[model samples]
Target: MFGDLMGMMGKLKETQAKVEETKKRLDTVLIDEKSNDGLLKITLTANREIKSIEVDDSLLEDKEQLEDYLILTLNKAIEKATNVHESEIAAVAKDGMPNIPGMDMFK
Candidate 1:
């Protein structure tokens, strides 16, 4: 029983290390999204940090329209980043975790 406990502990430690590594990698992931018929573009990291935004000069004439497009584009970029982050975390969990009952919850 003690040996089994030690083995499980070791596996948990290994899994923790993998999760940390995946988090670090996620920081470097970049996702791009566009909206308003491609008039607006946003780039963000998988960690949800906005890197850059591009907008067509034609939208500058209408402040209200520009604001709406900005909000929509930002939301789309954030959604994409979130999906990528979740998938990466799931992959790390699937690869590093042991086949214990209830472990599928992580996936």
Candidate 2:
């Protein structure tokens, strides 16, 4: 039992390291989102750090419209990023998990 426990602990540590590495890698993963009319384009890392924002001259003329576009586009990008981040981490964790009974986390 103790041996099994030790093994599980070691596996947990390894999985944690892998998750960390994946998160760092995600920092380089770029997600691009654009407004429905293509007047606003934004790029950001999978870590949700904004990298660039491109706006059309027409959008620049209206502050409220620009804010709305930014909010909508950023939310879409953030949702995509969150999905990727969660899936990657879950995959790494599920792969490294010690097969303990009743712990089908991925299911």
Collision pairs in model 2: none
Please give the CA lDDT of all the candidate structures.
0.88, 0.91
Question: Residue 21 deviation, candidate 2, in Å?
Answer: 0.4
Tens-digit lDDT string for candidate 1 (4-51):
778888988998899899889888999989995999988999989999
Worst 10 residues of 2 by lDDT: 98-107
- Residue 22 shift from truth in candidate 1, angstroms: 1.2
Q: What are the C-alpha RMSDs, in order, of all predicted structures?
A: 1.7, 0.9
Best by lDDT: 2
Off by over 4 Å in 2: none
Per-residue alpha-carbon lDDT of candidate 2 for residues 1-107, written as tens digits (9 for 90 to 100): 99999999999999889999999999999999999999999999888889999999999899999999999999999998888888888889889888989999775
